[model samples]
Target: MSENFDLIAVSPHPDDAEIGCGGTLALLSEMGYRIAIVDLTNGEPTPFNDDPQVRLNEASKAAKILGIERVTLDLPNRKLLDSIEARMILAKELRRMRPKIVIGMQGMTPRASPDHYQSQLIFDAAVFYSRLSKWEDIFDGLEPWRIENVFYYYTARELLTQSQPLQFTVDISTHFETKKSALLAYKSQFRAHPSYNPPIIDWIEGMGRYFGSLTGCKYAEIFYGSNIMTMNLFKHILD
Candidate 1:
């Protein structure tokens, strides 16, 4: 599996990438870019699910719906940490995949699992480690690969107005249903109990519409990046 990817989204859990950026990923996949999701953990031991494999099944279904691939690491769920081990594992995957663009979940969710925050830290380091030349010996002899960009996606856990200076929204009006269907595949999570999940559908739709309004689209997904964007011409910006 030494093939390269156009984009790889790193997530703390299975349903995270779906919730945060499935629409945008689906759109990119439809555009003929090879997209994949690298799940840091399988997101097991939740109150709703018993079998660990169930999450993987749901994650696969979601990936199929998005037309992308899924890779789950054997990292600790719920107890995930941003340690050197975690960084190295993810960096090795990044080197193997050689994705041009890397996406990760952003923001801290104190009310939710602590893995979200640590996942961000791990992602930050993994992207950095993936580009380190001399450290290839530690990664099973995989060659160093420099990712062109690192972007971040977020869910309702973060504020509506992102503080990041380099932020933009992707129009997902045509793929909004695709995103919703992918999220719904996780029956063990959203449909575990109607009262357990916080109206996830509404939350998704609201965020989509809110960002869409900002970008003059029907539905959208916002992303934050570390790079400063440059426009070559006004026509591209106008379009």
Candidate 2:
């Protein structure tokens, strides 16, 4: 039987969730939330990473750092397509995990990798498909499950050109270091390749601090929700 989760982050590649929402995941885990990340691709054949096994190991290590589970789907890297088959596969997983909150990349990322946008479409469709009673037979007869919330997390690659206003910010000040550790675990993709990219860790830290300043926190992560969120009380509001 599949384990249920309070939150599930859908990523285009193995390290995307770590790069975009690692601190948030770590904070949630510390708060005793059952969280998991589903990577659409293995993020292989990169400039520095040619071995799929190495990338898998790195993803596992990163998940451990955030105290969450990680599952990778058999999707082609750099060739993601938003089709019915793709949506059904993801929908099945959603039904199996039954997460209340679903996190995915922003839907309109024209400048970033195409896979990011494609991933958004896949998740968007899967969320709706997961709740279709007629598809229960196709999805292993699992009960229809509807996600309560769908949030989009920004990636470091889109930081410079991101224009979407933040719907809310998560105060991950305490889990900043935990996020860093998870990102650094992908040494093959970020640190090991000296010429592949600059100091991404520095950029991630700077981004966190910038977002935190906006919400009066030491470090934070921002997200956009598809629907307006209602708060019954002001106790959870940040200072």
Candidate 1 per-residue C-alpha lDDT over 40-149 given as tens digits, one digit per residue, 9 for 90 to 100: 99999889899999989999999999999989999999899999999999999999999888889997887889999899999999999999998868999999999867
lDDT of each: 0.88, 0.83
Best by lDDT: 1
Candidate 1's TM-score reads: 0.94
lDDT of 2 by residue, 71-176 (tens): 8999888889899999998998999998878899875566557888899899999999998888667988888898867888887565435465537778888999
Worst 10 contiguous positions by lDDT, candidate 1: 230-239
- Candidate 1 lDDT score at position 21: 91
Candidate 1 RMSD to the correct structure: 3.1
lDDT of the structure predicted as candidate 2:
0.83
